[model samples]
Target chain A: MASPVFRGKAITYGDDVNTDVIIPARYCTSFRAEELALHCMEDLDPEFLKKRRPGDLIVAGNNFGCGSSRENAPLAIMGAGIACVIAKSFARIFYRNSINIGLPILESPEAAQAIAEGHEIEVDLGAGRIRNLTTGASFTAHPFPEGIRAIMAAGGMVGFVRARLGVDAPAQPGRERKRSQG
Target chain B: MGMTIAEKILAAHAGVPVVRPGELYFAGLDLVMGTDVTTALSAEVFAQMGAQRVFDPDKVALVNDHFVPAKDIAAATLAQTMRRFAERYGIRHYYELGSSGICHTLVPDEGLVSPGDLVVGADSHTCTYGAVGAFATGIGSTDMAAAWALGESWFRVPETFRVIFRGRLPEWVGGKDLILRVVGDLGEDGARYKALEFVGDTIETLPMAGRFTVCNMAIEAGAKTGIIAADDATREYLKGRATRHGVYHRPDPDARYARTLEYDVSGLEPMVACPYSPANVKPISQVEALPIDQVVLGSCTNGRVEDFRIAATILKSRGVHPKLRLIAIPGSQAVFRQLLYEGIVAVLAEAGATISPPTCGPCIGGHMGVLGPGERGLFTTNRNFKGRNGHPTSEVYLSGPAVAAATAATGKITDPRTLMG
Candidate 1:
């Protein structure tokens, strides 16, 4: 509620971290949230799911999310409670998807190399700061676009849309939009 | 005052009169798409928004190719979710593991797209459809869901750049190399969001497969789509296909483009897109000597049967290098059967190439031949971005299937031209 707090350790990687490896082509069938979360990073480090803790930050090189543009890759990581991602750069599609889902993806070349895996860290969006609790290092990431930040502040695109229309949340298995005519 | 083919299409879809370049036109989208990941989340968003119906189910398509053949329990669940959403929405076109190929190829091949239409897919390479002369581009999944509900989307009318390939291509120089050279000339992102129209006699001579290869990498240059006017070749390719959809035409002779660059195809040698960027291209001669740990020959870009036949001929009686792991993935089940029937599969198998099911496999860094740390790979896929095939330190070299096959045999980069000789 308070700027969506994120507290976790960090995992590091270089540029062009594609979605296929993050979620894998094999696990594409699973739709359950819990199920998808379990397969995060099965390729880079088979033990990643076992070893990762909630609120962990994934640090990587440029062009993160370079191929396919699958949303599952980001969902799996975020659903696993990854606090945020800090990369040198990100693919155009993945970057926008992360923001729409209310996941924080920070870009900073220095921040990519500043933290080590398992090092407790906190990301404060309001202040645009990343606090490495273990190393006592603080890094700054560019502020999100105002419109994007507004969506994230509301929790995600769905929440933002609902808030924009001043409508009550609906509960249903699979319903269509009343505004579909637009 | 000049307009590009992309500009012409966007103008028609813009709902406004006379769209000019550099003007932001929030044009309505004719089609919006989501694959495995976005489909599930978008359904939830729909539920939260109390939406009872999509704007138009006919315009929506869903496919599960990202995590095909479900490597793990979680991925299988994601695929199921996408399948459920496609079914519940009555999405007319749905592709699963057995039916799925890369989304870019699947869309056009299934006849879901046509020229002059504006389409947006939730994947970057969605630009592939631009080969058909559609003003198609990739957008975020969230953007796609918005379009699903509203049937509208925004765009900035882009300027156009003309790429003209002239002269005859050497036998071994294929579409893959042509695009690589294009990427080399135009730095990655050089044409970001621009429309690219390819011209010249060389383009006329190249087959549809080669045209697709060039269009497939339009995204690498950050172009909205790469297009060539549909000619006799286009008519021939579309002749037997269902005529229910697709638009084809040649650009107006007076059509305006922002800039034009020309190249000679015969002068082109095999090229590779080095790690971290598709634009980082080098001739095969420069990198052909580097030892490789893997060679992959498939993807939407170069996974067609013609690519395989070309590779098979190069691989006949040749064995994979002892140190190289060569993986061959047919683009689709159709191609797989063709290879099987033609005995091409047998020859490839005898050459020590590991064959995988017809899925995107390893092209997007998925399962089936991910390179280990510091490992170098020569692949026929479109991209060679850093960490694209597993280890960030691993090097990926993008090439034509002929080049991949040739390199697999020597364990080092070798020119496909020599193999042809």
Candidate 2:
């Protein structure tokens, strides 16, 4: 598989930016991804929608997605054109949710602390390497395993599972995987 | 190498002799859950996956608690989608509006969980079942969708944090206080991606309902799950409900842990998480007398009968303040019926509390008791995040039943002990 890399300017925030502010419950009833992006971070940083450039990445302290299991948080972030998130840590469900949705996230307390807002950064997802171009700093994160990278590369679990069940270009994802419920 | 009970359950499901933290393993799920809030999206994803059917009907539970009784067209549509999916798939565990409650409590109450089970749900509070000694964790809708197709999902074995509680719990102080104290001490991210194994003399004597409360908020501290070994207390609770015997597991004496801490609950008091963060907890005595506009007494967290009993005791003869709108929600239909049979609902109603049907309505700010702008609410629910209950300008403060009941009576945050005395 080819190594995937992401480059973006960092938009930094402090610790414990929970999921509620990411996509408030008022909007949790489910809307199109682009529609949800309009309100992303409306509560925490009303400026987020205006401040974010396409391909901008979020850098934050610990527990970046800390409350609620609404998958909307990651979807909103991804829809907002954020390339990835570099944080000190993430709430467990949020971490997996991001992966499942093909939103790349890396945990690097070192990079998260040192990178200033608007600093340009580069990440090599396959190698787990981070480069802070502004500060000339370098960091390492535990890279995703081959299987997870494959999932993300295939545009997330939906597409990946479709491929796995041998459902080809003509049909839906995995008809061969089906069994009668009892 | 010794392993925690969570580790043991994961290993057994993963078809491995042992497991280590941070390594990915695909494990079979004993159960999977979705709610009205999540299932519509999951059903969509499952279709997108092109799977023709669910992995197993018996292992899946679809509960319409989050926004049920059809809060609006959108909520009703979600429930309708879930109903359609359940009927199409021949799922037997579908709990519709009247039968539904908070998915976390409803799953356990229905005997769907057993010791050593591996469970996942689209909602974060799924970890509540770790009280039954299961390795249960919350996953996203897509993950649950995949599980419905494949009967399993991959997981990174979490490191364990052993919390040993000592000393006796004082009156009006129970699992909610203890877990809040744990959250306050650990900070919101202290246990990120890790299992919080609760063990101590205090937990051994705590009632099953209290144990459920403690594990329910594991998400507040960012724990993968909060677990307790199923013992006599667990057996007593599961006696006749569980059709199959659960695999009782015990932590190896030498199980490795990321951290081990001791909490002396003997001196503990009723604690509350102030506005905007579950980790921002303060003992009731130390907090200011912040007046409240509303008080909510239930959710997946503290909606159990025991919780109602505690709150009913405090609000029994005392009427709520005229300015306060006190709402009580039993966690499930079963709990609601119990409260009704015990005449607790009558007592609550007479005391100016509105007794609502069992649904997760107000907790997620969906409906039932939404706060208007500038209003503040004291809740026994988890996650007091901004805009969590209603208007963005509104605030949410979290407590257990005792504090919720007492605060409703006074129209301000008050220590339940003071009211009791």
Off by over 4 Å in 2: A1-7, A127-129, A133-140, A169-182
The sequence of per-residue lDDT tens digits that candidate 1 reaches over residues B117-164 is 788887777777776667777876666776776676656677788899
DockQ of 2: 0.67
Question: How close to the true structure is residue B127 of candidate 1, measured as C-alpha lDDT?
Answer: 79
Per-residue C-alpha lDDT of model 2 across residues B1-421, encoded as one tens digit per residue: 8999989999999999999888888899999999888888899999999999888999999998888788888778888989999999998799976777888888998999999999999899899999999999998899989999989998889999999999899988999999999999998888888899999999999999999999999888889899999999899899878877989999998899999989999999889998889999998887848899999999999999999998888988899999999999999998999999999999999999988888888788888899999999999999888888888899999999999999999999999888889
Task: Kindly list the per-residue Cα lDDT of model 1 for residues A29-84, writing each as its tens digit.
Answer: 55344677888877666787777777678888777775656676778888787878
Candidate 2 docking class:
medium
Residue B155 alpha-carbon offset, candidate 2, angstroms: 1.2
- Give the interface RMSD of each candidate: 3.9, 1.2
| Best candidate according to lDDT | 2
> Could you tell me the TM-score of chain A in candidate 1?
0.83
TM-score of chain A of each: 0.83, 0.85
